[model samples]
Target: MLGRQQDEHVRLDHAVIGGNDLSEIDDAFDSLGMEPTYAGKLENDINHLSQLGFEDGSYFELTATLEPGQESPWWDVHMQKDAGPTAWAVEVTNIASVVDEIAERGTPVDGPNEFGRERPDGTYFEYELATLGTKEFGTQLPFLIEDHTPRSNRVSTPTPSVADTELVGVGAVVVGLGDLDDGIEVYRQAFDLPEPSRQTDEEFGAELAHFPDTPIVLATPLAAGNWLADRLETFDDGPCAYLLRSSDWDRTTERFSLTGESSWFDDRLAWIDSERLDEINVNLGVLSP
Candidate 1:
């Protein structure tokens, strides 16, 4: 188990969407009225781009392997499963303590590995990541990251001219699970997430276990006809969707229409189909001002 608890609270750093079709995914984001604030190449093997500047500090990262056969092990595994919005990352203040905690729990972690990328402006951004979920647990678990530099320096603020729709923060990350109890046990042991309050959504035909203190929600299909069930059937159990909060719901919906990407929208929520989002579900909901 993790060592004595530190004073830091777990916060989401970013969510990753990976695909081989870089240009297509880029175009899709563009069509959805989102503009990338920063772009960079990782080790000349992967391309990384971000649309940041959220008031709440969470960001979205779009990444793709540069070469056909020379993909990293992580990207290769994600692509083999479904390839879009594959991994999510959490920010931890003490990297070594977090790493030690996982190791002591019998989960062999790969790093406190340092990595960096060059910004378009020629400056470099560096950070250390401790990878927890591996071959044993599968790639669904989020890795822990600590930045050496200020996060604002790495992710710039989005201007109104560049961003038509405002993404305030991540409301929840929807994790698909084979067994709800097993999934809860794993996340609790790894991240110290609290016990979830369970509920059933009749509209989605799914049962949800909400961990209100954290940014994760565990989803399991009650039957075979719902969206969650279909996803669990097609892909391995992992992160399947992200519920993003919007600053202005109406304005965001108007922008969505301008993109002409097929999406479903109500007054409070919008669901962008996976076909338009690199096979990952993007749900946008309104956040109260």
Candidate 2:
């Protein structure tokens, strides 16, 4: 009977994509009809840029290491292996409570550490974060982010033209797990997340767990020769794709067509290949009014 309580403070914030080339990454997103804003340097080592703001308050961050061969934990852990979407962040209303909850569950927590980024206009945005679980979890468990400044100032609203397709928000993030039961237990103990609605998909030979009141779905491959199995082998059990919501599916498909990129879509949603998206899989679904 695990369910989301009203007091639960965590919500999806943003997902991070890492690359060595900034301009190339920016151009790729631009072709997707997204307007990116450069947020200047983060902690003085990583260059931060973000995509258009979504109604759900979730966005995408594209980052690149500014200092080559620098000993940066964020870059080394997330971006060192490949240039792709690697980590995600969650907004927490009360970080101390979250940290204490994790510690009570016998998981070693890292910071309550303060960090900030500057805008080109010279305004500074500050926040504190706490990391849950060990390095073994990698990008599977999102770090808790507590913002010190106004969220609007940190992420601007998107102004899309009538011809442009609107990216409404993130529907869910698809994460590949090493063990489905163990991953579920870890999330339940660490974050107190709601119980998931479970299903077995024969098409993919995977078990899917959709969490209540959250945009996270854990997938574990049940057999070989499936997309989940391929992702598990390639990314090694972590976030592999994001399910994005769009206001107009037709316009979004046309937008992808204009870029001369190959995409696959049905009546309900569209899938953009990772080769066109800086190695990140984007599944676009229609957003409800």
Candidate 3:
């Protein structure tokens, strides 16, 4: 059995972006100049996924239901509403030890459930996943993952275009909540994170904070009827955006057509123009590392 350490053992794995059409989501990423690798369909045949893989084994999992009106165990409302960042998972070295630690810290855990899938090339890979609480669709708390098969089999290498961009991996996940303090408390308790630095962004119309070195960002609406509030009403308090970390910030930005530049605390941030990502509600961001 693999042993585990504390929070240092956790790292950003992948953000699950759900949509109504899987193929359309693929085209959406392709339009952004990132090639999506088709992973495969779920065993239930209710969902399929394609991934935007990165250098550090992190990815953006673009997924959608295979059939309409069919309830998927993954998510119902988010998938129906084309919620971009519906859920997220962090990679851990030891599944059992981490689950035990979280449970001891007073958070409810549902698994280290054994899960696997077959790829298009007839290769198969498996992993263990555990929910932090009740297996709700858009829970603020992230799920945990550890690989049973070789991790490379599950996460593909980046294509040449993506490789040249120098994107390291997912840097942070932005979650929208009704109350920022409540969300912070939950994350702090679950992950043993320290008090985070806070700031309010007038341009984005939300007050956000980062949990030290972790990939979690908690945000709440600055006022009623703002974009964040609207997203909360639709997808509730779960992942709303994903920001990638780049090894070479200038090269990554020049490679893609970014709509505008922004800031995350002290780090420089840029956004992919939404117009380029047709039929996908996901907002993709890149941050200086």
Candidate 4:
């Protein structure tokens, strides 16, 4: 429901997480039982984005800011935080064309500029990007267009074996917003979605909504400056949760050593990633929308 794309209009391309080091994050997930598949890397005059492939063809890109003297559009402004889920990448027929259509709707976007590297086989590689607006929580996902066709030899799909900690797909995303109702309305209107339902326990004012099957849940912090509220407060809102799933929960948890670090756990509701990303547990909470 989020992007206004029909089932065939755009393909779920990549779920990107912005961080300082791609290999470190990959290694952490690998140690967590995920058989990480190496995608390619990109380096311009400024930043870099590295992708990790899943068996199902979808992948996650880890983006990072280049050191001083070099600047990237995303890093200088959006990535000021130590690290976070910066954007999601979706691919359509043409990145620029989709940008035009999305822009017509008045969605804030960035260039779908050409970028690439020289390959070992004497071939050149390139791709384009058109960033969709960031969520009210500052989560920015883009529509990526690879330069090559699906049949090209560059695109390889590995038969992935179920890792102990394999994230099947994004289950639910919990966001923190300043104006809860307005934030929900923003997503609802953007994706042509419906109103959300309320589910609160002793702790939070949880309002959950869905997009077809994708669930987007929202929660109000117990205190104004709570951890979730503090860092993400500036964006008018920001991502508070990462709902991840796996083939084997025990194996996945074991691989990541989550049990050692997680402050909380619910066999079904939420679980923490042991290798902490910042102070947050890299929470795997909720389920598909």
Q: Residues 225-256, candidate 3, lDDT per residue (tens digit)?
A: 98889988877788888887877877876777
- Runs in model 1 lying further than 4 Å from the true structure: 1-8, 44-53, 67-70, 80-82, 105-107, 135-138, 159-166, 224-230, 257-269, 273-275, 278-289
> For this target, which candidate reaches the highest lDDT against the unseen true structure?
3
- Provide the overall lDDT of each model, using Cα atoms, as 2-decimal numbers: 0.61, 0.63, 0.79, 0.49
Query: Clash pairs of candidate 4?
Result: 1-191, 32-255, 87-140, 88-141, 137-237, 137-238, 171-287, 213-289, 214-289, 215-289
- TM-score for each model: 0.79, 0.79, 0.93, 0.69
Highest TM-score against the true fold, candidate: 3
lDDT of 1: 0.61
Compared with the true structure, what per-residue lDDT tens digits does model 2 show for residues 1-289? Answer: 1111223454677777666555556666676656577766766555555455566577777766665334445646445444366677778877888788789988778988887777778887888888777743237787888888987767764434212346666655667787899989878877677787887655435687866666677879888757667656666666766666666666666655422222112113345543557443433323222
* Residue 61, model 1, lDDT: 74
Off by over 4 Å in 3: 1-9, 134-138
lDDT per residue (tens digit) for residues 136-249 in model 4: 223633344656533133333332534223555554455656666666666654444566655443343334433443335565555566655664555345455565545456
Residue 167 alpha-carbon offset, candidate 2, angstroms: 1.9
For candidate 3, the 10 contiguous residues with the lowest summed lDDT are 1-10
How far residue 157's Cα lies from its native spot in candidate 4, in Å, is 5.0
